[model samples]
Target: MIHFTPKFYLIGRVTHTGTQRDGTPFSQVWKTIDSLGSGTYGDVVLQELQGSPGGGCLHAVKSITKKAHKNNKKILTNELKALIAVKKHPTKVVTFHGWYQDSQQTMFIAMEYVSGGSLERYMRKLKRVENILISSTSPLLVKICDFGIAKSADIDASGLKT
Candidate 1:
């Protein structure tokens, strides 16, 4: 069995420079609060900046393990490319923070921690999400995309469902 407790560990966080989500400044150290999610390669953790400017200090930190698998490398390389591509024309996304790596063979991606229930849970009673696009284009058809399982440089993913 796995045991988890609130712990603070010093790790390299690849975070965006300057103010973060809602003008929250980035802290050099972060406290691991809990596990947000996980997958075959790694997991996402909810972390709090050691000394945030003020309230709203929570941020989602994605950690991926570096293995000898060529496929993993390819996926990571593609993800990085995709991220860089978006930086030029970032849109239709949440606040994007940068990424970093620790001494351990783990790469950490820091981004805006968007808190909310699942889409299906709050879709019918939609108040926030306004509209869904309908079109013949691939972009439009790909209403849902999973960047985690992204492998191709073309931005196509495996789990394209909510």
Candidate 2:
């Protein structure tokens, strides 16, 4: 596993070339930065990958992983599904790029990296009380992340697991 410290950003670019399981051409240049944060399932890292072939345009990459897929397979699947569901609403949610599993059975989810810190940390930095509430019309919008414990509301009324 690739380990990086918190808030680490590279100053230069590097090329990375590899092959998928099916033997397809996979070439990308990215600056792997420090981890964004971690959750019960795994950690999220910040990266910037080349957007086009032979182009300098770089896009933010959010790399999510799980140490043991067997123990958190269900949670991983649910998080992926939830991310895909909310991907269209980029302003209100993080965008899902793609996903793949490595030889170690570790699943990697590529997503949009939001540079802003978490809402909790931002509020604390401002020296605001924890109980303070902002109105709906406030310009600032905070998104709720970490969907590991999220459940689907489309479940059947009979309480049957889907």
User: Residue 154 deviation, candidate 1, in Å?
Assistant: 4.0
> Model 2: per-residue lDDT, tens digit, 82-162?
666665566666556666554445666666554555655546676322212222235665444445523442223343233
Query: Who wins the TM-score comparison?
Result: 2
* Per-prediction tally of clashes: 4, 0
Per-residue alpha-carbon lDDT of model 1 for 1-162, expressed as tens digits? 011121234453223334544665434556677776665567777777655554348767667878723436777766655654554333344334566655565766665564542343446676423122122243433121126535645644432221
**Each prediction's Cα lDDT score?**
0.50, 0.51
Clashing residue pairs, backbone N/CA/C < 3 A, model 2:
none
Displacement of the residue 126 alpha carbon in candidate 2, Å? 13
Candidate 2 has an lDDT of 0.51
Off by over 4 Å in 1: 1-27, 52-56, 68-72, 87-91, 120-145, 155-162
Candidate 1 overall lDDT versus native: 0.50
